[model samples]
Target: MEGLEQWKIQAEQWSQQALQYIHQIPPNQLYAALAVLLFPIIFIFFVRLFKRTKSNTIILSGLSGSGKTVLFYQLRDGSSHQGTVTSMEPNEGTFVLHSEETKNGKKKPIHLVDVPGHSRLRPKLEEFLPQAAGVIFVVDALEFLPNCRAASEYLYDLLTNASVVKKKIPVLLLCNKTDKVTAHTKEFIRKQLEKEIDKLRASRSAISAADISSDFTLGVPGEAFSFTQCPNKVTVAEASGLTGEIFQVEQFIREHVKP
Candidate 1:
């Protein structure tokens, strides 16, 4: 008890000395000292906060029968899980890539959301776009011509979305069902979509400024509509969700989500 009392007394003396020393310093110097000491603490706090809040979500979207659901399941299960019916609601999950489950240590989990391709349910995409690390627009490679216009329209909307455009989110035009002999090549699909989008651009531009519903316009005016003209990074790749050939999709995810 006596030793405790002495320790308390010594602490009080030290506190008093600290106060005296602080009082002896000039006001400006003391303020500068406080700032110097606090800056690193504040900086570290924000850095940690950002890292904690950074999203690992990847959004999968496309027209119905585009194989998004198949891809989603394949990523999570490493298998197509047999026949996959059309998804009516968003199929959401957080998991490590099934392919990565077998190899190596400490694989990061991905937050993947497969938004329904039906037009009615596509609105749900806006909810996740703000937090998405990247977007994969799955296209039906086998039926590319029949759906090219609709796919281009959907892709245009995504490219112009406020969140997607503002964040400069990277987009992957994934041509699904590439394993099929009739599947269109990525180069062909890309050129066709660009042509379709170019036509849409001309039509949409005729509308008055007040009537433009899209948050941003696509491509540069008076120039041919090309993926390169987009403010964000747009890329095209081929994949077969059913055949479990999705290395490109996995690469895109890791590029944005860091594992």
Candidate 2:
């Protein structure tokens, strides 16, 4: 009878010990599980918030002597002369503008990028273009029909080839050195560009039609903006008549760059 009683007592003790051991859990393990569940949620919330608040980037690209540098300086300082072209190669820069709109009764800040205007550095320009929300193509008004024509053609081809640009990037054209050409009105410049753009569109359409018939690959259509004739001329050198064209370019950007 004593042995039976002792065995019962031992069994009860073992049962109690087993229950305590099973109930005991480490605090560190609980904390680790909580962290694993909550960390991704917190991280995702911040990432979405950042995406909502981020500003868009704009790229300004063209050929040498296209007033890109002048525009950059003018946009940054509010005034600059259309000096001799300093950008023989590709370059990158930024400008900031304060914008106010009645969107949920709040104002916002907008950021812009100014790029060099060199034909040889087109590959570099393409690299930055994908991030651009808009593009500003600056042309020297005095050379619009002659030397500027080449630049215009280059711009069209570049935009058409870029996959990102194929989706209708807002483009603004700034006609610099307008003060030098007495006979050239804003309308004249617009008409000239419109004609050129139409020709390019017609050619591209024909090529696409042919490609379809021949079962060959066709490229993106060339796109150009409805010409906005801006007379951006300021005298950079008193004797050279290289006026400050950058301010005019900036004004155009401020008016046209979409949020």
Candidate 3:
């Protein structure tokens, strides 16, 4: 009818006007306009991929009496401060390492945090993990056999955390207290931890979903568990916080936190 024909003519006129406007623009301008529109999207993607925020923070974690606080004191001042009292809140500091102080303030300052090992306080670990450059998991080498299962359970939780796993945050399984003559070797401790975590993996799997705690499963299914199986870089090192033999821990910190 007459009304339908008139509406079609107006639509055709609008389409022709748009085509003419586009045709009037230069090809170079069109390309530049398109690029300007896409610039924010490309920049956002690159930011997520490259992680522009490189952190100087390092985290020390372990069960009570694994010498985490002692190591923190040693790294900051090269002394134990006559032993540490139990810290309900995290002990945090930003300072240049004591060993590198001889360089006359040349080295970069580290943002070190010692998360309390108490189960009630362990949840505080995640607050600093987002900005952590590395994680050092202290183990009591002198009491390895007695604490192996508990240590593995704690470490297993760390390994399965979404941030730790997805960010591929490097972990140092530090066997501390090697100053003791009866201290277990790092190799022995590593193997025992792997065995204990393997057992934990199986046991955790059998639990109901509602009772599960870890966010991710450790190691491949039907496979024996090992540090090598972790998505992140996992290394073992020996240290003696009491005797001031923590060279490896310092080296790991320096490697991760650049000057």
Q: How much does each candidate deviate from the true structure in C-alpha RMSD?
A: 6.6, 12.1, 4.8
Any runs in candidate 2 off by more than 4 Å, and if so which?
1-50, 79-84, 97-112, 163-167, 181-183, 203-259
Each prediction's whole-model lDDT (CA): 0.93, 0.54, 0.93
Cα shift from native, residue 210, model 2 (Å): 12
Tens-digit lDDT string for candidate 2 (1-259):
9999999999999999977865675778767877999999999999998877332565766666756666565555544554545665554544354222333543333355555555566666666666655676666666656764676466556545444335445665566666674524556665676667556556656664645322121232444433332122111111112444344444445454443
Per-residue alpha-carbon lDDT of candidate 3 for residues 54-148, written as tens digits (9 for 90 to 100): 89999999998899999999999999865578778899999999899988547899999999999899999999888889999999999888888
Model 3, runs deviating above 4 Å: 1-21, 25-51
Candidate 1 minimal-lDDT segment of 10 residues: 78-87
Q: TM-score for candidate 3, please give it.
A: 0.84
Task: Please report the TM-score between candidate 2 and the true structure.
Answer: 0.55
Question: What range of 10 consecutive residues in model 3 has the weakest lDDT sum?
Answer: 80-89
Cα error, residue 195 of model 1, in Å, equals 0.8
Per-model TM values vs. the true structure: 0.86, 0.55, 0.84
User: Which lDDT tens digits does candidate 1 get at residues 1-259?
Assistant: 9999999999999999999999999999999999999999999999998879668999999999999998998999987866778888899999999889988888889999999999888999999999999999999999999999999999989999999999999999999999999899999999999999999889988999899778999888888999999999999999998899999999999898875
